[model samples]
Target: MTQKYRSRARNLLHLGSTQANENFNQMVSSKAPKARHYGGSSSLMNRVSATVLQKNEGHSYLAKDLESIPDPIKLQNFNDFVTFDLETTGFGYCDITQIAASVGSSKYQSYVYPRCQISVEATKVTGMSHSIATNKLYLHGKEVQGKCIRTALLDFIDFLKEKDQPILVGHNIASFDVPILSRLLKEFGLHREFVRIVPAYIDTLKVARKVFSKEEVNGCYKQCNLVEVYLNIKYDAHVAVEDVNSLQQLFTVKLKDKCTDEDVYSITCKSCKESYTDVIKNKIVSKVICEKLSKDGIALQHLQLANRRDPNGLRVILREHGVPFKKCEDLARKIQEE
Candidate 1:
């Protein structure tokens, strides 16, 4: 454990899980959806202070042994962001029903009309049926699951493009929602360009741990369950609006404190597997990274699969390709904007 995280862990212990979370709900999570709406970056924007939310920190008592945690970013820049969640019909790389996004109190909810029978595990959790999703969900045959879902997404993008911008949000979005949705969108040939400003995506569960639950629990394990976060914040479970609402609450509560992106970025690195975080935090640098990847004889298009971000990931590729980090960072942004 480094001195920084050790200090963080110690502070988290005193906050006690529940109180710490509520503070975050009130401070940080609150500003997210609206922030993404304006084309900023990240779900939350501010500096991070462990003491701001937690009175005492929790640690595993050692720093080196603490490398297994999936460090999530306590993102800010709520100036332009969206709060989104999905009630999937199945888990892990499968189609889902109920995809909901919210900007402040206003929300966008739609159900996908499944082409096949709903998965049993999914059925157990969400109680959604093929019939119910098809017959009852809002976008059954429109632009989305039907025309309605599709239209909502289209309108959502247009709204995002217009000053609002898209910052796709949901629980565990990076692992399942993003990869699956991006594939689905491209497969269907849907036009999903985001707002003029580059979109900065966030996952509420990740935000919760980064801001509220700073204890020494395994970040990867903690992130796997959204219910854990809800319960910790003293919020109700199993309801889409309520869960997203809780996340929003979490976002607002913890962010009012002063914290930097570097803090969140470092914490996130401890949990998730990625090579370069510098790119994850900077869009222009990431753009430079894409260029470096191409120069290295790597497949640029394939590397961008689903916009799965990591400045260091691309940077490592460049390093292997003998490209200078500063050169890639400086040039890629220019290329991307042009």
Candidate 2:
């Protein structure tokens, strides 16, 4: 182990797992979700410290010997990044069921109780049945699982903070994962904490879609799903940790020699700009529709009749006025689908 992780492991041992696990279990079992104080910065730092220490037992997925592993950054073309993936309950208005992330040599994975039943369609895609998600378990390296979203996110926040906010990389994370996480944090009153630790996101889905848009599988264009992009590669799908591992491999293999570091950074910036600009356009469209609604007396009358009671009626009015009645974020996603 490197000096840094060695120091972290020692600090974690000082905190003692017995007490931490007890407190963590109590917090998760409670019916009402509460903001995890984590006993302020010092206590939180201990948890982050412990995150680096893997169980001493042998595990298939863990680094065979931590000391033997090279510096993760030097090995990678891009060093400062955490490749993460989340398995969610469903498409929209969903809760994250599993969260997995990798930064440097440390990897984290946990099943998150969404606090809502998983949908059939979601279960079909992720294979995360309600029972499997709710049960306490372990990942390949004896990594504990069955943390509530609040706990999972709180720990994730600490991990990011400890890592100095590395770039977030994942498939379709910009449009789906980040937004979904933002909404959940808002619901749990941790949105500010999440925003405070926010890092630039590199949506590999966007990169792959742009780079391989014309690539066909069986004479049909392939989707930007992580598995689809690397279909021939042997790896488990829907399992967050496996997916993240595959994502990193896919990125390194596809992009290593294709573009210089500067070229990659430039492309990343352009992609981010295009995404933001589309959002701005949608906001402008929303404003235009609202302004028009304010001026049209007849439409205003119809809006008032069912106004607060009937949201669909308002949508119809907006549609009639040649305005799409979707929120800015929704509109941006719709534009992406085109």
TM-scores for every predicted model: 0.47, 0.49
Measured by TM-score, the strongest candidate is 2
Task: Estimate the TM-score for candidate 1.
Answer: 0.47
- In the range 67-124, model 2's lDDT, one tens digit per residue, is 2211111113444567889998888788788898886677878787665667888777
Which portions of model 2 miss their true places by more than 4 Å?
A: 1-79, 131-144, 216-232, 256-338
Can you write out model 1's per-residue Cα lDDT over 1-338, one digit (the tens) per residue?
48766645532332223553576555444444344452454423332232222212222213322222121223454354565666655756565466666667676665555444567667655656554322433322233333233454465455455444345455666555655555444333342233123234555555555665445334443432434443365543434555566665545554325334432222121112233344445543454444334322243332342124654454444455445767755544433443
Error of 1 at 68 (Å): 37
> Alpha carbon lDDT of residue 266, candidate 2?
18
For candidate 1, the 10 contiguous residues with the lowest summed lDDT are: 263-272
Question: What would the TM-score be for candidate 2 when compared with the true structure?
Answer: 0.49
* Clash counts for all predictions: 76, 0
Show model 1 residue runs off by greater than 4 Å. 1-78, 132-149, 158-166, 195-198, 212-238, 255-338
What overall lDDT, based on C-alpha atoms, would model 1 receive against the true structure? 0.45
